[model samples]
Target: MPFTGQLEDGRPFIATLALQAHGTGVVGDGKQLKFWIDPWLSTEPLKYKFPSLFCLEQDKRCNVADRIPDCNGSHAVCWNWKHYPATEMEIEELIQCHRLLSNVSLSKQVDRWVWRQEDGDGYSVKDARNWIKGEVLSVNNSVYQWCKWIPNKCNIFMWRASLNRIPTKDALLHRNIYVENGLCGLCGEVEESVDHLFSGCRFASGMWDAIASWCNIPRFYVFSLSDVLLVLNDLPYTAKKKDIMYGIIIIACWRIWKARNDKIFNGSVSSVTLLVADVKSLAFLWFKCRHKEGCIDWRNWCNFVLPVM
Candidate 1:
């Protein structure tokens, strides 16, 4: 895989293949950047942005320089398609592709890749590790907010649930795992999904109702797990109270997921009363141990009363 010369496919190549790695962005000279495969035009590779156009391309590995030989020339661009776009969709995609590449002009400098996670300092082991951690712990542009009050396992579970990454029955089935049934283990009704198990199932709804009454918050109706997490934001409470409520909500969801697993794997039936009690108990224990002062009264906690600090 020589990088300096032309590839066997006749695409002009660059001297570095570092762009293939994560957290690297290209400073395009066009000679080395694959027009369809590299993220030279945008943050995403062109092949993904215009799948139809990519399929029609005859030279899949053509360089940006090969496609747009002389950017300043009158006829600056050329198309090499297996067959020219015929359908309306294909034509639309081709139009979009051309529009995107229209502004791109080649530079005399050689193409090079640079680390995007660091600013002026370039790449380092620490920045790479941090970038990898952030990428792994994020989903759909939502980063995991660590809750020190709860156990690390609960925080991790909440992060996974937020992404619908939990191995619910439906998720398991999607992964081609053998699931005898996809029905909710707790409610035995709807398909077991991260959202349904934590927010939509009848048992889950009952548990949330109990939790709401215990915490003195208005009953919340949520269609998704992420919605459940945001319910505390609209509440009229002090920041400290809201923070505590956030932990309670997280712990409740964690308990709900645990109950669902218990039912499926241990033949344990879920009771809303028992589940709510467990959420309260477990949350109290975690918060008490992890709180800075560890001076919160159990009665006030049970009553959802936190003195303004």
Candidate 2:
């Protein structure tokens, strides 16, 4: 093809072709040479001319006094017409160093390289105790990361309880630790534990009865806090609803503990109605939404319990 044929696509290619058309001197050898390939200029020749064209119109900063020695970013030129594109081998070296590779492939390489890094016994001693009590689990890695990114109030006490290896049963016992009478303070039974106090004991049973009727939750379903957690975990597709339900569980536990504290320390022996009211209030404060079970707003929350107590 004639030099002009290829020039139609790009100015740099055209410029290189034009140089080839007018070639006279050999690059190194004195033997007669035909039109030569300036590899550097052939690759994006228009880009090569741009900065000088820019320099011509804008401030002519290079005061043409000294021979502008060719380095890297700065250009090498003797006068306006002197011809030199960055060297072909030099450009190739630069291109090699640059290296535009795909992220997918790179990450795959990294993932394959790491075998045992993700292997057995992922838990440290710190997280091990919690692993036993059902707090820490490998499946919840993402959840734990997100939880730490934005601090959760529950995580601190929960983790402290975790580190102390506080058995859920033991912590539940501590809920009534201040009760000096040794017997069940609420129902006058044996020493309290998590299962006994919250599940079987009469005190919490009364609270659950009121809660069940208020929410229209089945009487059979009014079980322990773990059962409540199972319900929350199994909540239907809505994330907002699930979070609110979880908050309800937290508030319920807190309110139950507060009732225990009131009986022991405060001497504020309130009715079950008051306790249920506190639960609803705390739920609203925590979740910022009126928690309702079956289209009934927990508005007159006190009314939910007054009759049951």
Compose the digit string of candidate 2's lDDT tens values, residues 165-284: 333334444566443455554555545444444555556666677665665554433223445445545534356444444455545544665566667668777666787777776654
Q: Can you tell me which runs of candidate 1 are displaced by over 4 Å?
A: 1-139
The Cα error of candidate 2 at residue 25, in Å, is 99
Task: Estimate TM-scores for all models.
Answer: 0.54, 0.38
Which candidate comes out best when scored by TM-score?
A: 1
Model 1 lDDT per residue over 42-75, tens place? 6678877887787677656677778887646443
Q: Who wins the lDDT comparison?
A: 1
Model 2: how far residue 275 lies from native, Å: 0.9
- With a 3 Å backbone cut-off (N, CA, C), the pairs that clash in candidate 2 are none
The whole-model lDDT of each prediction reads 0.74, 0.39
Cα error, residue 1 of model 1, in Å, equals 26
Cα shift from native, residue 147, model 2 (Å) = 9.4
